[model samples]
Target: MSITSANQLELLQTAEAVAREKMIDPSLVIEAMEESLARAAKSRYGAEMDIRVDIDRKTGRATFTRVRTVVEDEELENYQAEFTVEQAKQYMSDPKVGDTFVEEVPPVEMGRIAAQSAKQVILQKVREAERDKQFEEYKDKVGTIINVLVKREEYGNVIVDLNPGEGVLRRNEKIGRESYRNGDRIRCYIKDVRREQRGPQIFLSRTAPEFMAELFKMEVPEIYDGIIEIKAVARDPGSRAKIAVISYDNSIDPVGACVGMRGSRVQAVVNELQGEKIDIIPWNEDQPTFLVNALQPAEVSKVVLDEEAGKIEVVVPEEQLSLAIGRRGQNVRLASQLTNLDIDIMTEEEESARRQAEFEQRTKLFMDTLDLDEFFAQLLVSEGFTNLEEVAYVEVSELLVIDGVDESTATELQMRARDYLEAQAAKALESARALGAEDSLIEFDGLSPQMVEALAKDGVKTLEDFATCADWELAGGWTTVDGERVKDDGVLEPFDLSLQEAQDMIMTARVLLGWVDPADLEPDAEELGDEEAASEEAEA
Candidate 1:
């Protein structure tokens, strides 16, 4: 078909119709037509010639042009598309390199093969524009709940029609063994949107904790108005779930508001979630208090929190033990997820036994190390003296608080404790020296003799080795692997070194060893000091 013979207005109409159908911009379609026409013109003209086509948006008239560039002699690879400066002297008075020469060319007559190629090119461009539009539309919808109609099932994966695009609810993302058929209406959380080789992938999830949170936001007006905030959520898919919420307004109870009058609001959510049971717990700034609420239906006798380790211990009566642990430990597991802490639940009897065991251990340590009888050691342990260091460093007034102990007795007790610690320190220093520890490390201001021995055993015998160590490697930390927290034991962790202290000591070592400039750290030190001051002011 000859380009001139076809109706020019037809091209404009086709572009507009395709753009409207694909929900894309009309300019994209016109640009694609221009490119396809340029490709076809290149086939009619020599392929090496620089040919371009421009379509008028108003008139739909296709204009073809041949372009050539003036270039250096060596750079003139394409004779038809590029020309040397000397060769272009005939066309112009003077032509420099990088100058372009353009002239109008007759439009190409499209044969069967060229027509097919142009059609394919236009289709490809339209598809690309559509994919881009869909990606942008869905990407903004991530972390939101959307309604979709199930289109089909493939290998246990549900493909849903989202009107503007399609989404996939993978089998694992579905709640339990819930199955869907064609044309099933489902509400899903827009978990993620990714652009891949095939197209934009909209990942939908029904089991996400955020889905429940979103549902509550939709059902409860206070949550939507920002008066009630969903602090955290944990889900066991179709079986059970827990959500922690806080209310900013004193009159509104977040949990009660979510539960609604006669359980109407919560029931709506439960019906949508395949009858998944939900525990709506009130959120608290105190982690232990929040955890107590999370592990509901079980009375907790005591709560012990380890903030640094991100762990908590809950002591419950023997009768409540089974309820706290729940079936197969689901209750505790949900509680852990809700609070973002590792929980250890123990019965009251078990906790009592554990405490007794610890008391005996501390009593034995003092009895053996301080040359004291068991009765005297137990007295010290009962007075909150756990180790020899505490006894040795404590003031005499503290020791005098013990029953039947005078000033002289307090002095003698501290003397014995100090003597034992000094002997142990000397032994540790000798062991560290034997392990090739240098004075540079052993004499480091903050490190004790035992700390040096521990570092030496861990192959950090030099000051440089200590400087190269990461803070976490010296103070211990918890890491999440496969959704479970694993403990990373630090060499100095047994010494009770904090992460901030480890960082300061490492930086000090580096500065002293000329590995770091003291001036370079002044800005950071100032920032830290400013932060501390700000924190103190906030506390005040």
Candidate 2:
């Protein structure tokens, strides 16, 4: 191959076409072409010579040049890279060291290898520019939907063609059992954009709950207009879904707006989802009401909420039990996710039986612990006394609520409860002490009397021993109990601590033992102590 005046037009035309095809700026293509030409010119100029190339972006004409730095004789490293002052003086009258001299050279005759090298340079630059463009375009578009064409499927991964470039839809992001064919147009949310060695990766997803929410935003005008908001969504993909919606405008019913007129709006979404059934429910501020709404189409006779435990018990009629639980617990599971509460569903008959058994158990407990007759125990149980702890903690005024239990009887029962608790606590503390437990360990804030006893038995009998214990060990580490892994729940049932709480207790123990500076613990403890001492002295 050879370059001539006639073929310069062809070079310019080829550069433009390649730039357009590769989605790169034409200037970059021209620069790449020049660099490739310079490399080829190097073969003739001598490999050690510094060669450069410049191409006109407008006219597609190429120019060759050689660059050398002017240097003193002793500073010259290579004769080809640097021109001594004597040689430089011939080109310029006042040549100075560190000055660069660029001399124009005739264009090289294009060769087979030279053309191929130029082509590779242009292709490499174009690819880099394309990746940069893809990254910039899609980085800010993550969490938003984009239209794509299914280019092909490779090992269960779908190759999607976007307007910018080709993207990947990994198998994990695909909805369960959803299938795609080549040339099929689809809509997905841009989950992430990552720059890798090959190119920028734009990941698409159809399974994210956020993706489902975006679809609703597109389909529901109310949601887009901010008249309604999607609080949450739970999907059993390709089967069923539940969405919770709330309306900011009083006049607009959020659920009705999402469902559209005669189900047109929801049906549109359903059609796009391949006939996935959707239940749009109105959100409520009251969690119990919201939970009931989340589990729709099932008649809930009653809902018992235990907010502290994050659990809700729903009792339905015997005939509606299956419906409430759904086929394989789907309905209840979705409801739990939407409401952020664990749900337990039972039949009305089952709830009644449970209540009766609880009543008998509590009545018997009162009889044994309070030494009360059957009638009095029954009255105490009816008045909401479940265990000896409640009897020991309840106020005298509350005990008076029971019929035939006058102030005298209430006072006597309260005395007995206090005596029992004190006796039990003293026994635990004495046992802890007898087992070589330090007073500091026995009196730690978070450690119960029974926990101190247990620690003593385990040879952790001092403040240092308590501080060194792990959160899991302090809270009753996992132990095999009746073929099940259960935490020790401390030296006694219900004396469990969270990991953070246990860590805090350890820090407190360290501070008390002078292992940690009190100043560092609270920053003002020393000052506060001084102020208190001064005040006491003044009072004295």
Best by TM-score: 1
Q: lDDT for model 2, please.
A: 0.83
Tens-place lDDT per residue, model 2, 330-371, is 998888878877788988889999999999898887777678
RMSD of each: 1.8, 8.0
Please, what are the lDDT tens digits per residue for candidate 1 over residues 423-475? 98999999999999999999899999999999999999989999999999999
Q: For each candidate, what is the lDDT?
A: 0.94, 0.83
lDDT of 1: 0.94
What's the true lDDT of residue 287 in model 2?
A: 92
As a whole number from 0 to 100, the lDDT of residue 444 in candidate 1 is: 93
> Which residues of candidate 2, in runs, are more than 4 Å off?
1-15, 34-110, 170-179, 430-438, 454-493, 496-540
Model 2 TM-score is 0.77
